[model samples]
Target: MISLEHANRIVGATLEKGKALGLKPLTVAVLDAGGDLVAFARSDHSSAMRPQIAMGKAGGALALGVSSRTVGDMAADRPSFIASLGPISRHGVIPAAGGVLITDGNGTLLGAVGVTGDTSDNDESCALAGIESAGLKAKN
Candidate 1:
C-alpha cells in the first residue's frame, strides 16, 4: 500500500536529490497501486506542465509495469500504436523517462514515482534515489 506519507517521502527525497545535484527545478508525482495519485510536489521555477507530465509518467509506469523510459523506447519503435494509446488511455500513456515502479523488499509492487524537469537520465536518477531512500526497490 502506498500511503500518503510514503508517497510524500518519495517526492521529498526526489526533490532534494535534484536540488543537491544542481538540476533544474523538478516536479514529482506518486501513484498508488490502483493508479491514483497519492502525493505530488513541484519545485520553484519548474514549468507549469511538469505536474501533468509527472502524472502521465506515473500512470504509464503503473499501467505497463515498466519504467516510462522503456515505454518511450517502445513507442519510438511503434509510433502509430503508441499515438493511439494516448487517447485510449485518456492521456495516461506518456512515453518518456523518469517514471519507475516502486516495490517492497519482497519485490511486491507498491506504486510508482515520477520526476521531471532535468534531462531524462537525471530525472530517472532522482526518482530511483527517492524510491531507494524510502527503503523500497525500484523496478524497471
Candidate 2:
C-alpha cells in the first residue's frame, strides 16, 4: 500500500527540491483513493490557507479521476458541469493550480497530489516530481 508516510516522503523530497530551486513555501497534500488526506505538509513559511487549497485540488482530482489540469480544461469547455461540481464537491472543488492524479504501476487510481505557493506551473512540476519519486504515475 502507498501509505501516508510514503506520500509524505515524496512531498518532503519535492519541497526540499523546491527550496533548493528558490521556490516559495508551499502546502502539499496527498489523498488516498477515497479522496481522503493520507499525507499533508506545509512549509515553515507557508500560509494557513495553503493546506486547504492543496486538499481541495487533490480532492477534485480524486473525485474526477483525472488531473486537475484536465479539470480546468473541462471547466473551460463545460462551464455547466464545472459549476455544478463546485457545490457537489463541497470540499474537493479547487479547480486551481497544482493538482494531479496519482496512479499505481498498473494505472489504478491510488490518490492525488496538490501543491501551492509558486505559480501553478511550478506547483504542478513539484507535485509531479513528488508523485514520480514515490514510484507512482502522474500526468506529466
Candidate 3:
C-alpha cells in the first residue's frame, strides 16, 4: 500500500527546498500504485496549473510504470504517441517534468512523486530530497 505519511513528508520537504531556492511556489503530489493521488499540496502564490502539472507527472509514472522523464524523452522522438496519450486514460498520460518513479532497494514500485512550478532540474532536486527522506530512490 502507499504510505500517506511518507507522501506528506515528501511534499513538505519538496516545498521547503523549493522555497529555500527561491523558486516559484509549486504544487506537489504523491500518487499510489494506481496513480491516484495519495497526497497533494500547493504552496502560497501557486497557480491553478501547478496541481494538474504535478498530477500529470504522477499519473504518467504510474501508467507507464516508468519514470515520466523517460516518457518525455521518448516522446521527443515520437510526438504522435505523446499526443495520442492525451485521449487515453487521462491520468495515465503525463509528460511534464517533475514526475519520478519511487522504488525501494528491491526495485519494487512504491508509487511516484510529482512537483511543478520550477524548472525541470529544480523540480528534480526537490523530488530527490523527498525520495531520499523516505529511504527510497527516484527512478530518474
Most TM-score-accurate candidate: 1
Whole-model lDDT, candidate 1? 0.88
Better of 1 and 3 by lDDT: 1
Q: TM-scores for all candidates?
A: 0.95, 0.90, 0.92
lDDT of 2 by residue, 6-123 (tens): 6987788679768877999978888887877787888897877888789888888877877777888888898788778867784557776589987788877777888888988888
Backbone clashes in model 3: 0
Residues 1-140, candidate 1: write the lDDT tens digits: 88788888899999999989999999999998888788998888888789888988888888888999999998999978876777766337888899999998888899988898999899999999999888888985
Clashing pairs in 3: none
lDDT of 3 by residue, 6-35 (tens): 888888888888888999887889988777
| Model 2 error, position 27 (Å) | 0.4
What lDDT score belongs to each candidate, Candidate 1 first?
Answer: 0.88, 0.80, 0.81
Q: Which order, best to worst by TM-score? A: 1, 3, 2
* Best-to-worst ranking by lDDT: 1, 3, 2
- Candidate 2 Cα outliers beyond 4 Å, as residue runs: none
Q: In terms of TM-score, how similar is model 3 to the real structure?
A: 0.92
